[model samples]
Target: MFKMKEKWRYLKTEDKTAYANMAIDRAVLVANSECKVSPTVRFFTWNPPAISIGYFQSLEDEVNLEMCKNIGVDYVRRITGGGAVYHESELTYSIVIPESHPQVPKNIMESYGRICGAVIKGLKNLGINSNYIPVNDIIADGKKISGNAQTRKLKTVLQHGTILTDVDVNKMFLLLKVPDEKIKDKLIADVKQRVTSIKHILGDDINFNETAKAMKAGFEEEFNVDLVEGQLTSYEKELAKRFEIEFFGSKQWNHRR
Candidate 1:
């Protein structure tokens, strides 16, 4: 049996979604500096639906805020670099582990492969074939079903991703800025061609809660560890509150270049 050198924390957040996700990422980054947690895996969903832009992306250039507000979608910025993504209709997963953790890979692509392997295993459990595409996407038949990003610090690594259960192709187009003049038509066609969902593959509605549970089990098996449900440590809670105020809840950080 493989033994993990640190404790594993399993956290499920009900509908806190964007802020909670960002808060947990920050908490894990700080916690990694203080202790060796085998790794923390969080399963979460969004409420009041939101759009998250990548770290280096220009909010004005990448997102149409007026449309977002009109549709009651909250706009937030991610700490990782990637394109903007609409967050509804997806199950999100975030993992936090120390950089020195045995399961944590050294190179970025290798790390993505390692983390996405768990996702592959999870999808296979549902009889859906999936594979990891380099640089961080989980694909089925060349169409992306999930997208992931990672951030590394001195002692910690935070990797997070979204698994599509369903997506609104039209709404997604309305929320983001596309360069082409015929973007409305192009975006709709492109998304239909390039993105897919569990519902589309399984020929039925996916039960997200079951999927989340399967994902947690997949990680536990992959890492060879017992997953114990836990809450944020007092320190993590404090940091989360602070992070919500300083970074996640701030317009400055969201708009920062």
Candidate 2:
């Protein structure tokens, strides 16, 4: 029997506070697990900027909370395991799909390579050559341009990541705590050498929508599916609010190692 053609939801770009963004991703994952929504791809940007740490990372060890607050940057812990990331001047995307889906590899590393391939295609759309460097990074010209993280819950997989349009390594270092202040300068210099952004490569600033558009097309092509534009359902909205209050925005959740 021939398989049915696939169509995934494409949520266009929106700017949101850090808590709301994380809440929405989780809400969508839950909704998709219940089979209430189609496999979805959504893009968004951070408002007022923020720092998101991995699930297993210690908050105090990873982030300088006082500096974050003083500089009006939001901070939160993610449900996915990885290093901390400073969200700003970039496009963030989340994709929700079932683990049993044929296109999704059961092996975590292969799955990362497959999903990160979509991002590589997206960069190509913008006339940039990039490659996927496992376990979860995309690079351009030997410098990292994107970082991704994933989690499997309720038998569903949610992978989200950032595609940097511009980078400010200096500002990011200020908000992230260093194990020893002595190596701070060397670390920053090393990062600057190892990381890059769209603007740095293209010599132009690509706005959020344009970057998102490229990424959407990338997923469609990589998965061989149509991406239909959509919005959050009422149920998703309500769930996001609850998630924000109970988890993402809560002091207890963010502070919990």
Candidate 3:
């Protein structure tokens, strides 16, 4: 989609708490919207692991807070809308670019497919062929290996998603609420059948750094850009800090639904 300059910033994977991670994503979106930073592709992992619920989702309805607290898993609300996701043994990536950018499609579905193509290519680099399914999912070996969500704000678009390195369906189900207790087991089994991970597919674990490297190349190849390693700017850092304290880290904001 990009035909202009073939360059983008690569913010290598960083491990952080749920709040800090979300803050950085929002901060980057703001900075990119203002043209203060190059369009960025960043990767991150949730420290202590976490469950992030979608923007319109209710925390109480979607998550089991007592279970989360007991398991030492953190929780946060995402600016993007999607089902609650259990983040563990996974690589999460976010892309930030102005909505008016020449490469951005006016149609949402096309845009999702175009962006997710980068992920499909990344999975190919890992020797696991994958395809982008409409809406927002990547399937490998006929099972979902990644799920993505996107939102538009501040005249910019932000899309973030998880590529599973490993998966523990039982642990994930424990942290999420099922509408019916009786159907919980059935749901879990269904998910197990439908979702997959890199470890499961490759019969081994792929470290975060290695996965990030492959993903970085995926974006570079898809966009035909050179992904130069970089760090968050001073403005972005300060904004992230403020955003964490005021929004991502705030109970009122998280529970606002």
Candidate 4:
């Protein structure tokens, strides 16, 4: 059985835009590699709202650009692959581990499953039963409660996921063009009925801090490792500053179709 090392760091960041959050994830990965920082887990949220398209998705196909601008929502591309996602009323979690680490699974799907298992445990603690769907989703009653993506480089892997605490289903439908022929209205209605949130499932508002603490505890218990509260290393901070100016904040990267 694989076991993680004792050294693990946890970071909880202030709310940021989607692009900056993604850039920070990459910067942390680079910093970990260069500084040999221990495996890291980060929790964060978005502010001013944003929409993120998957690494390989076409913006025109996935987003209504005019609608987004009119609504004051920013748009950016993710470093990981998945369908487009609207990032509001969501808490995002990311874990970066060296590929050489024993706890890091060899297969991508296995890695996702392991990380999502922590989320499942966390939600269960709050009385919201959730299950990990293969390939990177956490589902509750057949509707997606969370979605994840992964990126690997230089013998390091970064896995991140979004936990949908609350979402605007109607606005989501409006911003992204759903294939009308794929699913009939009845099936769509069924999906909406099944998809739910902590608030929906438990009949109470789920606070972000409570959720984050629960998730951190779940990770600690699942991995059987002590988590040290930490901040971004100097290297990571510098890299994030550079990345924000050059790529994440650039129109070329954001508008690149």
> Considering lDDT, where higher is better, how would the candidates rank from best to worst?
2, 3, 1, 4
- Ranked by TM-score from best down, the candidates are 2, 3, 1, 4
Lowest summed lDDT over 10 consecutive residues: which window, candidate 3?
1-10
RMSD (Cα, Å) for all candidates, in order, is 1.8, 1.1, 1.9, 2.7
- Between the candidate structures 1 and 4, which one is better when assessed by lDDT? 1
Q: Which ten residues in a row have the lowest lDDT in candidate 4?
A: 179-188
> Model 4's lDDT to the true fold?
0.82
Give the clash count for model 2: 0
My TM-score estimates for the predictions, one after another, are: 0.94, 0.98, 0.97, 0.92
In angstroms, give how far residue 27 of model 3 lies from its true place: 0.3
Regions more than 4 Å wrong, model 1: 1-7, 36-38
Query: Which candidate wins on TM-score?
Result: 2
Candidate 3 lDDT over residue span 115-138, tens digit each = 999998898899999999899999
- What is the overall TM-score of model 4 with all chains considered together? 0.92
lDDT per residue for candidate 4 within 185-209, as digits (tens), equals 5555765775677777777788789
Please give the RMSD of candidate 2 to the true structure. Answer: 1.1
Q: What lDDT score is found at residue 106 in candidate 1?
A: 84
What are the per-residue Cα lDDT tens digits for candidate 1 across 47-102?
A: 87888888889898988889988988888888888878899888888888888888
TM-score comparison, 2 vs 4, better candidate: 2
